[model samples]
Target chain A: MQNTSLSQANPTSEDTSKPRKARGPKWWIDFLVDLAGIYLFVVRFFKDLFRPPYEFKEVLNQCYIIGYKTLPLIAFTAYIGGIVFTRQSRPSLESFGAVSWLPSLVGVGIIRSLGPLIAGLIGAGKIASNIGAELGSMKVTEQIDAMEVSGTNPFTFLVITRVLACSLMLPILVIFTDILALLGGFTNVYFGEGVSFSLYFSQAFSTIEMEDIFASTLKSVLFGFSIGIIGCYKGFTSKKGTVGVGKAANSSVVMSMFMVFVIDLFTLQIMTFIRNILYS
Target chain B: MADTKSNFIKPLFDYEGRSRVVEIEGLNKSFGDNHVLKNISMELYEGENLVVLGRSGTGKSVLIKCIVGLLTPDSGKLEVFGQQIPGMKSYQMDAIRKKIGFSFQLSALYDSMTVRQNIEFPLKRNVHGLTQAEINQRVEEALDNVGLLYAIDLMPVELSGGMKKRVGIARTLILNPEIMLYDEPTSGLDPITAGEINELILQVQEQYHTSAIIITHDITCARMTGNRINFMYEGEFVLKGTFEELSHIDDYRIKPFFEYNEF
Candidate 1:
């Protein structure tokens, strides 16, 4: 009994005093634990999603937050990217005496790859980090536990709504980004080469195949889902105290950005494979 | 020696005739290599306040958390309302959770929501058929009970520490739970505010006829709110008695808790 009380009084000593066998590397153990946690989280999300009493109001509110609130930033980045890419490529095209291809060049670059990638990275930085911080603070404050005790499913109310909103809205944001980029490109072209609006748009749309639009939209949707899930998972598993919130937010952004790149790589490979099969 | 000591203490504080709302026998819980709870046993009867007095990190909070299904015991029996909590499914635990209100140490009010919204949240989720008017009435009544009716429209961030505790209590009481679990309910408050909270706890227990397991080190709170007191040390109840009975005991292990000079 005295030994038990002494052990309880100083837990660190008890832990260190015992000689225990190694259980693999610490990092590998942590990775496995994190992977299992994410798996459980995904399973819980789907379970709640298929169950009755869907949270439509919460989903719409999240859409308004994750989509409508993010338009300005997306528009700004797209516009800047379009102008810069057009300006940089114009000189080379002129040197090759193929300045007429400038519009199509910028269009394909912006629509097929740059637009979705940029939007996803932006969402990862903004929405993913924001959700992570928000939910991390909730966890620290026990608000999530309060929700659970109140008979409100925190997984459904917090995780599902945010995940669904991001997945559904990122594609829309990417489309909007593409449109803004094209408009910026057209503006630059009209001024630089004295091309008419009709001519510039025609050149741009001429090279944009149906496959390009489909693939880009698909990438955005997947990126959105990854960002949302990673953020929620990080925040949900955050440790106690204020520092945990900061760590959650930072890790969420980092992981989401990493996932975006990975997803983009696989998507491009899949798209190239399909194109080859169809046109070979 | 330990067995004989516990046997000598156990019969002196027996609560046999009353209906037990929560019962635990030989419960154990551990975190990594640290055993937080070991061979713990207690019973919370209907409409009684069981104050668990313990030093920091003595597993008092873990004990109540186990009762409320937040933390699973490593082994042994833990039954609440005759249902074993450890083996219960998520939905089943949630069903049981509706009857148990846990007031967290930090109040745990949703910062994004106003007090009215926080109070209304449980009613809207738990009581499906309640109309807006009925929900509003209940929210107001809960707020009124806590004497914070005016703070209803204000957000949790705008609330003071004492006010947040009151709002937490109001939110917990809104559902009229059969069991209330208060984890350090008055830990960080001023003495006056802590007294008010303790009084409010007693009032709620009496008014709602709910059994409560309040985990705290506050002697004033223990004296005011507890119908019976259980002093926990090293994950086991060292002594169980009324405040007056336990305070008068000459055991050195229990002496510091009653000694007023330290505070």
Candidate 2:
């Protein structure tokens, strides 16, 4: 007989459950359970984020896929949206005799609200569904299980990299969206009012505050986190078979879009409260 | 660079001159109200192919999943190499997992990666200080073992079912796993392909001298590859013995299995 040897592995994925109580209605019970699962999943992401054997290579790859690949879609939509919104808003501003205020108005609107919302919605749609379907397919087909058996943590390799990529890439995408949308506004302003390039940009930057950019970036980051987490949670826990994968993909898009608006509402309230307390 | 770090898992030898690598006692698993595994007890000795024969939904997959730390058994003792592994986290099982290779029912090769990348994955992630050439050599060796070196660069979608299974085996084999857990290795294949897979399982055993737990309902696969057999039905073992001993048994639940698959 020959002597057998052993190799090393470090998967670092998640926990399992034993017999537990189920209270309340089935849907309510499932809701609480899912809530708890998402909480743990997010907590584990932070824990695994700092753990050793960091997968920077995979993170970079995900950034390229999530950020670079989605650029074209964001640019086109943001530009078109800028033109349409600016054209509509100009009539109201002109009626109020604020035609000269168009550049500053568009700048504040896009930076403080429009740019982030567009980027958030677009990111949620593209990145969330893709992650959801990809991870869901892996779950059902047992590729994730295969990774666990191989000593590589699928969560770190799959979830953390994706979530981090979304978080890091969204703000950059927003910056691009902000620029392109402002340019779209510029096209409309130049055609409609014959405004010069330098004068229009000067008016745009005059009302822009650093705090506004910071607030928008913060919102973008949160939106990115929601996009990553919801998609991952759905995909990671997806069940049944191909149907489950499809459901995961579909729900990721819907949930992510809803989350972006919900987050927007809450953040709007909090920022308002802070501003009132500071100024009043 | 060379790896100086080593991990050793010494198997426990019983008085009968056989070592039990995996020892399960009173194992039970359930989902919601459905009791999938109930009061199951079994043993797998060193270098032996132990087949857990069963029909669909007999909790065979859950049983092996528990052993591999994919699913936590609701209750019971599951020991691998004398270490208890019930409800343990993934990191806790990593050392033990390196020695256990599980082949899924549907060959779960990483869909995005090529066959070469798939085989190279484990080594690249876990094993340290190996040059690219060394990794490539091990990958080629593993694929060659499964007779799939020709399809190394191809993606999984391009391969046939049997070829995918072969690649999955090659991926696991590349890890140098001491204990192999095959989840219906011959399922979803034609008779000829299934026969080839069974032959491959035997060849892996003969070459690697690895202990394996083959979960299958196919009696021919059991007869061909299992050193001992345990029949699973309704979440419990109904019958167990060597192929010759099980073939002679006169039980109703066991009769149809052999008559249906073996005849």
State the DockQ, from 0 to 1, for candidate 2.
Answer: 0.25
**What TM-score against the true chain A does chain A of each candidate get?**
0.89, 0.88
Candidate 2 chain A weakest ten by summed lDDT: A1-10
In candidate 2, position A100 carries an lDDT of 95
Candidate 1 per-residue C-alpha lDDT over A1-280 given as tens digits, one digit per residue, 9 for 90 to 100: 1111101122122322233566777877877887788788878888788886688988999999999999999999989888888999999999999999999998899999889988999999999999999999999888998898777889888999999999999999999999888888887998998999889888888999999988998899999998999899999989868899999999899989999999999899999999999999
* lDDT digits (tens) for residues B142-241 of candidate 2: 9999998899999999999999999999889887889999999999899899999999999998899889999998888888988777777778776666
Q: What does the lDDT read for residue B81 in candidate 2?
A: 96
Q: What does DockQ give for each predicted structure?
A: 0.36, 0.25
For residues A200-258, what per-residue lDDT tens digits would candidate 2 score against the true structure? 88998899987788788989999999999989998998998999999889888888999
Error of 2 at A153 (Å): 1.3
TM-score of 2: 0.90
